[model samples]
Target: MAIASVATEYVFSDFLLKDAKEPKYKGVRLELALDKIVTILAVGLPLFLISLAFAQEVSVGTQITCFTPFNFSMKQAVYVDSFCWAAVQYQADNSPLWLHKFFPYILLLIAILMSVPAALWRFTGVPYLSSDLNFIMEELDRFYNHAIKLAKNLATLDDRDAEQDSQSALDLAEGCFKYPLVEQYLKTKGFSCGLVVKYMVCQCLTLLVLLLSCVYLCYYIFLASLVDEFPCDVRTGMLKNDSAIPAAVQCKMVAVGVFRLLSYINLGVYLLLTPLVVLAALGPARQSSSFLQAYEMLPGFGALSKFKPIYNDLSIYLLFLKENLSELKSFKCLQVLELLQQSAEEGFDTMCVLQTLSQVKTDVFDSQKMGSITNICEMDKPKN
Candidate 1:
């Protein structure tokens, strides 16, 4: 009979283990979809437009036009235009006009600057944060399965005249349920704010770059409009004292109009993006404040309080029992005991657990209730 009973117990335990489903873990996305779309557009549009401008210049085969003297042949006129464009550094009084010559290169530089923050986050920040989140999620899954198995074992115990032995068994099982791994890991990571600080820095850098690029674009547009045409000094090097070559030639940059148009497009898009960058910068601060407020409201609970499982109010209830068991009357205690046993045997939904706690309050505690009890058991609903 003893051997038969032991074999039956093994079968029952195996059945319960097979019946408990392991929770599914979904990966957390480091960047929001909207933010990613905005980054690509804001950084990529100008680059694309600048490439188009360069293509236009190449197809036309002339970036500047300069008229030579009437006596010069077609080849000499071409030489004059080519020489002037190659050395097209125009100086009015003391101010320089080099920006007009290298407008496309400047736009390319701006595009590179705009993309730096996203690249930095992707390479340095995302990997570390992702690994940490995965570790935490896996640990939480293990803790949840452990709790369910303990509850099932407790429920399967004999509920006969061995009441004292059953209570002792419950204490022993609870003692074994302690998970020091998660707590120790958290303690080691408590002082590190590397990920949070990295996120904030990235946002701030993006915002600053956006503002500066807007200002630079506005300045370029204003200056380009005023000084697209300038007098070029062709009387240099070989033509320093030549009587045939003129000392100065009036020349006009052909790509200035296109550059101004590209600047306007870039400025319009960046102006629209300014508000998004501001909001992104503020997101972490708002979340941190809200999280701190919630944590402050819970007195005895520590950092891992945020990690309650979706279907396991009994785990938290057990913690409360450990603390307040002596204070509870026999009738209230019996109600809790019965609730735990039933939950372990048949399983319970969140609503049923809530109703049971409310009954315990109204029946034995004279309508006085612990507000934190409700807060603790309000686990996040699993996403479908």
Candidate 2:
């Protein structure tokens, strides 16, 4: 176990080295089961027990059911209870109390509060997991597409999984890449360095959240988890004037047992999530090394060699006239036009986007994305 933790840290530290280097091409992704049941179990059990403690308090109902002077009426009994209680200034033994009291509830409340950040993070943060997988999946699909396009001009498929799954998931994810904002988000400048960084950051956030939460829970747990046993000054307030009262009183909190149980559960979950938080920061590059490498190679190669960019600019100005020129389709024609236009004219400025577009290539169109893009593009189309 210790070795595994060390290994996890080692893997993360290794990432720091790569942060400064060019990313490699090894596209992997993380897929974990999302059973809200497990999440509920992790967070819910403690709260449920806290509730159960409340229920017990309701059923029993008194802090210390002392036999005050029988002469006292119910209200007077409460006062005597309150007075000595006030004098003792405490409760939690002899009978029941939490019926109206709020301390343990507050402690339980704290435990529940501690669970909130992690709970929200798990549910909200991880739902994105499926989407994230879709992201890599789309990226992989596009890589295949570009490979296929380039492959047509080149020889065999370089990547193993490419040629096969080509029609499989891509078929299902067809057009899934149309408006790949998430993928774009993954790659700031067509590089997913930000994705890894964001991932690491989010992990740190998770760790900090959990760590802070654990601190809260630990304190509450320490307070609540205590055997609920303590001593208090029995003769304070008015009782201070009374010599009959014991100088000091023994005080044992009633719900510590329940709070202890709650704390144990909270502590356990926090401990478990702590490492996952660490992994989140470290695992991105390893997970999507393939995609990163693909994205990284783009800027280096995405630029205009010379003529194409120049010709492309002239083509844009004579956009109407250029429509007839199918010559652009052949790379050889561009050189003949030899920088006829400025470098900006003939080049592929759209390469980065087109490339990223190519990376997320899908066989089919994302019905929804297709419609939206069509609607938007139709709106953006030049007025003829």
Candidate 3:
């Protein structure tokens, strides 16, 4: 067992050195799965639609087709298509028809705008939150390990040793298991409302952009549906006096059908994302109580409501933990510590507590092994 332990520690140290430049908390996600899903779909959908729209344009060969007199040659016909496309924007009567030419550009703009909120959060919020969360997780790891070891030590003590050293043992347990690092970190950060404000601003921006995109898509599809063919007056510039060039030629925009389809698809997705953004924005506020209640049973958990700033900060921390719950090992550590805290308070038998703590230690170790395996798999993934 000792040899195995040494080998395991050496391998872990080597892995750490190999990945020294990478983030220590690379497994931790900064955003919720919901946020990632919404951001990906919202931003990716437009880009995909733009590519499809452009592909349709390329496949069709030309965006505008104009009718010419029978006397006009093939070159003249090509000129008509080219001239109508160039002057598609200048035709005041068919202004909405111009959108068919620039539909892909519009989708590109929406994609860039949709991505802004995510970029804002990444730049403005991630650094502070990441450091704080990593620190809390590191401390939780230490605190839980200490608690489990203390439980095992207490379990092995004979009746005489336990009785004689009861005071010292209890003092050791209290010192080892007490909240210090995380609590102190939260206390120092309690007064800061910057993270909350930054988070809200990003969510609100996402909501606003989604709403606007839906509205614009609705308006665009309506206008596009009304006008696919428009009259193009090609008798301008040098051909002003040429009566043979026909006064007004009817031109059809070939790509309008594709644009309309893409618009409907984009609109449907944006509508779906709007509600999700609202839910994400309201999540921290609505769910803070239930999550924070778990920590209430632990020691040093003062009357949180009395200290509003501290409570808010703690809520923010729990919110991040909730976001990263699936990947975070610290959550299990916290659960074990909470159980230990309860056992100590209820005056449980040392042996019974030890049994419970052993199960917890087993679970924690199993989770850590799984996490290490997952990290290895992730590291082996080909870098983009």
* Candidate 2, residue 128: lDDT: 48
For candidate 2, lDDT tens digit of each residue in 154-265? Answer: 2222246645654554553445434444334434323223333433444455466567757856765555344443444445566678765445444444544555565677
Q: What is the C-alpha RMSD of each candidate to the true structure, in Å?
A: 12.4, 21.4, 10.1
Give the range where candidate 2 is weakest over 10 consecutive residues by summed lDDT.
312-321
- Give the Cα error of residue 16 in candidate 3, in Å: 20
- Any runs in candidate 3 off by more than 4 Å, and if so which? 1-24, 175-179, 289-313, 326-330, 333-351, 355-384
Number of the candidate with higher TM-score, 2 or 3: 3
- Candidate 2 vs candidate 3: which has greater lDDT? 3
Q: How close is candidate 1 to the true structure, as a TM-score?
A: 0.63
Show the lowest summed lDDT stretch of 10 residues, model 1: 289-298
Q: What is the per-residue lDDT of model 1 for residues 1-384, given as tens digits with 9 covering 90 to 100?
A: 465346435533542223226432233555655457657977898789888888979987998888678998999878877877776664655433567778778878878887888888888777875565446444433443354345445434554634676587667655654434544464455445676566667778888888898998898888655676667787877778898877788878788788888889989999998888887655443331121122221112145555332212222122222333233232233344344334332333332232234334323433133333333334322236
For model 2 the local lDDT of residue 200 reads 41
Ranked by TM-score, the better of candidates 1 and 3 is: 3
TM-score of each: 0.63, 0.40, 0.79
Model 3 TM-score is 0.79
Cα displacement (Å) at residue 296, model 1 = 16
